[model samples]
Target: MFCYQCEQTDRSDNLLLGCHSVKGNCGKDDRTATLQDVLIVICEAIGQYAVLLREKGVVDPTWAHRASYWVFTTLTNVNFNATVFQRMIADAIVLRDELKARYEAACTEAGETPVVPEGAAQFVPDPGMAGLLKQAPLVRVDANIDVLGADVVGVRNLNLYGLKGLCAYAHHAHALGHRTDETDAGIEKALAFLGDPPTDLDSLLGHALELGSLNLKVMEMLDAANTGVYGTPVPTQVRVTPVEGKAILVSGHDLGDLAAILEATKDTGITVWTHGEMLPAHGYPGLNKYEHLAGNYGSAWQNQHAEFAAFPGPIVMTSNCLIEPQPSYRSRIFTMGPVGWPGVRHLEHKDLGLLVKAAQALPGFATTDPERSITVGFGHDSVLANADAIVEAVKAGDISRFLVIGGCDGAKPGRNYYTEIAEKSGDDTILLTMGCNKFRINGHDYGTVAGLPRLLDIGQCNDSFTAVKIALALADAFDCGVNDLPLSMFVSWFEQKAAAVLLTLLALDIKNIRLGPTLPAFLTPAVVDVLVDKFALKPLGDPTEDLANAMAGA
Candidate 1:
């Protein structure tokens, strides 16, 4: 097994670059790791076939969504069930063969000999696990590194990983009934690029930056999907304390499934609560309309083992980042929409009947706890609507600087750095946060300045687009470019999606981003140097020192 798709990969001597042991740092075992690699190789072939069909005016938009799902399913800690992958693999092969036949026919009609491809584009998976495992070694990440050099391999992986993260965002938007012509074409184009990668290092690096530009468009699609379906997010205080009643904790990043469950259990007296990244659901107008949709229930995803066990009702994980459920609550946990564990019940067709009934039977928190809450819904619309006031605050000395502290959260040791920075931020500084990392320092009371909450909670990690929007709006209000604005980004990354977002920032020529709690292991030293020299990327150091550096020019 070999995997280095996330920040938490093994770093022990001889394992600095990736994990080749029985299990990855995130608990993915050998079989699952090998199957994931095989699945990606299959996706590349599927894209190759799809692109070939595009030459005949046979554009299939659904393939883009499918490609998005394939990449999303391979993200770290997303899908662990090998059976699910096997089914997807079988389907992809059938489609590939069908498209190949069509492409060959097109060539024959034109009196041209079709060139059959080798490698991943023409792979035929062996029926059994042994055969599949045999093919895995040939397609693993390190397969071409020796010949292509680490710099080239690293840049290629950057594009691949960025595409994975972009597809994850695109998948979420597709769930809400959103799609566009460019989004579809871009998805297939990027997948096919990876299907037949370029050998030139400069070309690969250029494609990586192109992915960053494409991600910007993907993020916009998601932004529209959320606001159009759920109504623009508004500032609303979400209760962190439990209310009395039978509760169902909806976790992960799926707002659609949460909406369904809320509708299903509206009159049942079984209250609905959010966990992990689902915390932001409380701010959306469509979701907030449910009176029974109670407040957030847990901290970050890493604390789920204890949090899920302690909760009295069933938990529904609608998306990725699902860990191995403890035996105590594994019986009550339900997985849906690409998230799976060995023993947990998988919900089909977004059904919550079984899980809802379980919640009704369980004795939920019988009494209401102390009222403690946090204000959310500071999305792009919310902040930009008050652009004039924000600009005035800056001019009047009410606001000194702005800090964008957002990204994925994890169980790693250095995560306290986020909490410290947010805490140490002066009253004159406004903190804007998103993603699960907000859980680290969101509870603090940073008083409002210029009629805005000091710490603004932009929607989810996918809502990083909101930060970009707010930044540009602020820059426009002050008549300057984004880089010239008094804003600093101290991002925390734990997974590939964060890496993709970082690439997007660089693609926009937005520089001076300080990334932490650790850099990606997939990036060799040479690759890191390129990013530093080109984009002014910096690593997180002492909180005070980093903060000082961030405020130096503000």
Candidate 2:
């Protein structure tokens, strides 16, 4: 396996660029890794054709969206099925050939010869695993690292990984019937950029920053999609304990699927509980209206192995971050919409009848648990609506500083740092949290300051933009730059989505961000130095010491 897309990629004292073992640290084997690389290379070629078609005034949004989907499926720990990737590769080649014919015909009509790149544009994919494995080394991430050098490889990966995250966000938003021509065009351009990547370090670095800017736009569009389709999130309390009934636990980030399930099972006496990143769905008024839409059931995505096993009823993964199923719950686990496993039932036509039937058949929790709940739904609109009060609290010294302490969470050993940082924060500090990392400290009582919950849960990882808006509002109210505000960010990264968020933060010039549990293995030492020099990005040390340093600086 040669995968280094996530922060948890195997990195020993000697090696850093990739995990070249038989199995990656994330449990992906050599076949899946090789297939993922082949899929990406094929997608890049498709993007090349799409770019030519766009240049010829033919606007087909399908190619751009499919390119994004192909990239998104290859994200760290998302898809592990070699069959799915094989199908995608086959589909991509078909698209590539069609686009190539179109581009050549257009060029010929214009009395010009079409210039086609050689790698993926001309190469044909093997139909079988043996042939695919033979071609794997030709397209693996480190295939050209020796020639392009570490710094250039690092920047190229930074852009690629960030684009992967951007597409994931855009995919979810698009599923909810919210996507724009502007966003589609940007995705095509970024994918084409990948087809013909910049070799020089400076150009690659510039492209990485441009990717950051593009990610910001995609994130903003996602925010609009989530809030515009569903009502803007408000402060709603979500129950942590289950109600006594047949239950369906929904995991992952797709509200569209969740909505369909809720509507399908409405008034059926079966309860729908959210797990993992779906915890924030309770905040949306459109979703919250379902009385059977019960509370959250699990912690972060990494804990699903245990949590899903213990849960008594059907469990549905609506999107990414699905792990290999345990035998205990594998029979009951179902995947929907882009996420898949070898044997798991994949839901199509937006139906959850099988899941509902499973819930009805299984004996759910016999009795209700203790009445425990947490406050969620403090998104940008909710926070900004209370802007005057927050400004006053800061001025009166009631709220000392704001701490943005959340991002993607993983099963790494040192992730407890986020929990400790949230726990040990001073009474005067307000910790604004979004994403799955909030699961670390969210179960604990942080108490309130100035009538506001110190630990604010601002929707999913995509809602990082809401946190950005809160920062901008504070900076604007304070009449200073965003970095100048009495706010500090401590981000815990596990995947490329967090990488995209980090890039957006850097693009906005938000400094002094402390990122952990570790930096991406794809980033070389020189690239790390460049980030430290330019954006003041800090790798996490001791949690108490880091919190002390942040408070002291504030």
Candidate 3:
């Protein structure tokens, strides 16, 4: 098996390229990796037909939405159950076949000859698990790397990973009754191009950037979905310390599941605590109204092994970044949506009867912990509403710059760069960020800039639109372009959602982005050179040096 789709892909001395051993850094076994590869091949095939069917208006968005959610399942740290992947593979083939038939029928009914897609789109998976596993090596991500060269394959990974990011965010939007035809069609179009990939380097790069531009729209849709369902988030104080009660800790990036769990357990003597990306839910008016939706716990996804094991009650993961569950907490931990682990119980249709029972059966907090609080809910609308004061502060020298440091966080070493950068950003600079990356610097107090909180936690990675919108509003208030603002973006990436966010930033023509813990393993030297030269992107450097350069306009 071969995989290098995330920031934590094996990069040790021997295997320097990607994970090729019995297991990946994310703890997915070889069998699950191979099955995901097989399913990825299916998503490409579905894209080939879904793109055309969308154009013809032959079928509704059933297949397009299905393909989007299906690809999401293959993202890093999402699903680790090989048996679940086997079932998804079986179901995907039948879905792809039905989509193909519908596309053909639409062409025939219109009296036009249909052109069948070739390569992965036309091929069918072998029967059963063993046969499919046998086919896995043939369709692995790097199958054509030797022929197409690393540059071409690198760009292809860009497109494919970008597709994964878009689909993952789109799934979040769809969950909140938000859907846009353009976003759905763009996902299919990118998938179709990847099905029979082009060898032209420029075409591949352009397609990848298009996926980036499209991802911005998906992020916006997600922002709208969250705000439309829950009220727009406002500045609010959230208790980080434990509240007294039988508690349930809900982690990951799904607010819908969090809201459902809150409603299900309302006044039942159980206090629901948010974790990881779910920490920002405390700021939403709709969710905060529940007296029992108490406080956030722990840090980012990578720290879950320790935090989950210590939590006194059952923990629920509503989205990505589920690691191998420890034996101690395996039974009490539950998986929801596309997140899955082999022995962990899964939550379906927001049903938490079993989870509720588990929560009651386990001992919760014995008493109230110390009152520790952190202020969240500084979303785009919230920041923009304070635009006048922020602009005034910048002009009066109260705020020197806006250092936007954010994106996904992982278990790697160099991630401390984000921490140091934010800490040294100084009180004169406003620290803007989102996702678990904030965990690096949020623990320290940078104080306020112009009466506005220094570190702005917009929300989860899904709330990326808020950061961009805040930047644009700041630029507008300053009467300058976004690139001209005194802003420096340092993005820490761990998975595809971060990939999507980077693409959106690049597509908006944002420049001087400092990306790290390391460049993606999938990017060859040539592709890296091309990105650096084209977008003026820079690899992460020493925080002191980078900060000086950012201040000196280097």
Candidate 4:
């Protein structure tokens, strides 16, 4: 098997002969590595097909969805089941053959050889392997690295992982009947770039930032799709109490799944409670009208191991941020769409029969007093509506600074830095947040200024588009560039969606954003330097110092 996705593999060593022991030392079976290679090649083919479709002005939604899903599925820890992998491979092969046929037919009609896009065939391995070696190779593993170390491998890993998350979000939007040619093309270009050999540290770093920039567009498209379908979110209060009786806890970022759950459980005596990033669904007018649509459970994803353990009802994850479940809640945890965890019930398609039955058999949810009431829904529309007031408040010195703090939360304890930063912000500051990451400090009563709550929860990570919109609106109202506005973006990234969003910001030349709790593991040193120099990107430092810097110029 020949593969070179990661830095650990020796480029000079093409043949795997007599290297079984060395492969074992790297903790990857030769068979698995070969499979990964094959999968990458298939992805390349799909990417090429997508490009052809775009050129023909007949983009296939199914092809885009499959391509994005495959990339997301290949991300670390996403799909470990060999059965699932094999199924995906089969599906991919079928899609590739169909696309190839379509391309050839189109070429025949035009009387020409199919002109595949450049770099599309890089991942395809030369066919000569034995029958046993037909599977794609597994990705080679890498050792951990310091969060700030300028390691090329680590940077690359981070870039790829971030792209995975972006692709997942893009796929979800596409699944919901939303399409963006720019977003799709951006992803295709980024993927092709990833397959390209790293020329130097600078080029890789620029690519990483580019990934962030593209992600921004992806986020915008998703935000538009959601808000257009569900209506602009308003600042509505969510209760924390579970309704005593049967209920379903809906988690993840898929509003489509949430809508189905709400519809499925209506009049069935089973309630729905939002969890993790789904908490903001309560603010949507369409979803809020459901009398039984209860409030949120747990603060964020990291606490799921403990929080989910105590959930006495069925739980459904519409997307990512799934933690390993405890035994007590393992049976209750049901995943739909792309989210999968071993031993948990996966609700395929829109079917919720199992969940409904499970809820019926269970004791149902509690109906106690809510822990506390917190307002959410301050999406782009709401923020834009209040743009004049916000600008006036800033001009009058009532609100000195606006801080965009959002992204993922992790098990790492250092993440408390976010909590501390949120708490320490001056009374004159307004905090805008999105994603599960905001739960770290969402509960803090940061107070209000000029009729606006200090802490604004702007939906899920994809809603980072909302945050961007607010920033751009503020810039417009202030009659200056986004960078000139009295705003600072202090983001925490965990997965690939964050990476895509970061790339979007970079693409727009948004600078001096602080990213942490840890940098990605795939970036090369030259790549990091490019980011630091070109975009003024910097890792998060002490909250006190960072906050001070954030407020100093404003």
Taking the tens digit of each residue's C-alpha lDDT, what string does model 1 give over 1-554? 87777877888854347888888888888888878887788888777777777876778788888878877988988888888888888887777777788889988998988766555786677889988888777778767777888778777888888999999999999999998878888888788888778888779888888888889899999999999999999999999999999999999998888988898898999899999899998989999999999899988999999999999999989888888888898889898887877767888654668877899889999899999999899889888888888899899999989999989999999989999999988889999999999999898899988887899999789999999989888888899999998899989998878877987898889989999888887787888898899888888899998898888852
The lDDT, on a scale of 0 to 1, for candidate 3 is: 0.87
Question: In candidate 3, where is summed lDDT lowest over 10 consecutive residues?
Answer: 7-16
The runs of at least 3 residues in candidate 2 whose Cα sits more than 4 Å from the true structure, single-residue gaps closed, are none
Residue 272, model 3: Cα distance from true site in angstroms: 0.5
Per-residue lDDT of 1-554 in model 2, one digit per residue for the tens? 67788866776745555678888877788998888888777777877777788789877878767877888888876777878988888888888888889999999998988887755676677888998889887777776877888778778888888888989988888887777878888887777787778688878878778778888888998888888888989899899997898999999999989989999999899999999899999999999999999899989998899999999999988888888899999999998877877888888655677878899999998999998998899998888888999999999999998999899989888988988898899998999999999888888888889888888999799899999889988999999999778899999898888888888898898889999888888788899999999988999999999999998762
What's the CA error at residue 85 for candidate 1, in Å? Answer: 0.9
Worst 10 residues of 1 by lDDT: 115-124
Location of the lowest summed lDDT over 10 successive residues in candidate 2: 8-17
Better by lDDT, candidate 2 or 1: 1
| lDDT, each prediction | 0.86, 0.86, 0.87, 0.72
Which whole-number lDDT from 0 to 100 does residue 459 have in model 4?
A: 81
- Model 4, 209: alpha-carbon shift in Å? 4.9
Error of 3 at 260 (Å): 0.7
Runs in model 1 lying further than 4 Å from the true structure: 14-16, 115-119
**Candidate 2: what lDDT?**
0.86
What ranges in model 3 sit over 4 Å off? 13-16
> Which candidate number has the best lDDT?
3
Clashing pairs in 2: none
TM-score of 4: 0.86
